[model samples]
Target: MTEYATGLVYPNGIAADEVNKVLFVADFTGLHILDLVTGKQSWLSDGGGTYLNGIDGLYYYKGTLIGIQDSGNQGDRVVRFYCLLFNVDR
Candidate 1:
């Protein structure tokens, strides 16, 4: 297990796959998947070349992981958001 210091923030959303015994954690940088049995963590997606930051909601459904990303202030642009679907395998 890993620990973080106070004021160090990340991982905004989470989802659990009971059938596969896995945990999904959404961070501002990427999507993190954790194996409950092995305690190993990996990235499902890194948002490379995509607007996939500020992830606020997470859900797992039928081999797909859905993420809700809120686009925070990027210059004077209006704040927007979008949902992303990722195919995740157990």
Candidate 2:
């Protein structure tokens, strides 16, 4: 298996910009960026920590990556807008 991002547990799928060739991986833990040509990897975000710590369904729309998350808030059905690249791994 290829390691796209570190500390990313349970990555489901990936999307990319065909023009740019930048790869984006989806994980219940967070999002990871992989360079197609350089083979370099980087962490994108934790999706406001609402990913249930391990879930599924990763999609991209209008240059935005959207996914469902639990956020430790059970019994409540709420959706919140989150900033992309909130937590960048160094």
Candidate 3:
């Protein structure tokens, strides 16, 4: 498969957090959060696993991110992580 963000991970799996306004990219390098509003990138996990080959899929449930990690050794696996949204009243 073709992969972008060469230095990072995943290169495939991607997710969207509507409420938080962030897009989660599971690109093998790690879990990345792209700010939907500003189009900024942030890392969640530097290296989720040894082989962060790809991100099969991603979804949001109860304000958390549930996704799949595709690797070389293990075909595919499901993983869960938390996403926090900070609210500031100006």
Q: Count clashing residue pairs in model 1.
A: 0
Q: Which residue pairs in candidate 1 collide?
A: none
How much is 81 displaced in model 2, in angstroms? 8.0
TM-scores for all predictions: 0.61, 0.53, 0.61
Which prediction has more favorable TM-score, 2 or 3? Answer: 3
Cα error of candidate 2 at position 18, Å: 4.7
Task: Give the per-residue lDDT of model 1 (tens digit) for 1-90.
Answer: 553212214878777764766777777666666766666666654345545556778877665666666657243222222223322354
Per-residue C-alpha lDDT of model 3 across residues 1-90, encoded as one tens digit per residue? 523233554366766665656666776545666665665566665344544346677787766777777656377778666555522121
In order of listing, the candidates' clash counts read 0, 1, 10
lDDT of each: 0.58, 0.54, 0.59
- For candidate 2, the lDDT comes to 0.54
Which of the predicted structures, 1 or 2, would earn the higher TM-score when compared with the native? 1
- After superposition on all C-alphas, the RMSD of every candidate to the true structure, in Å, is 6.0, 5.6, 5.6
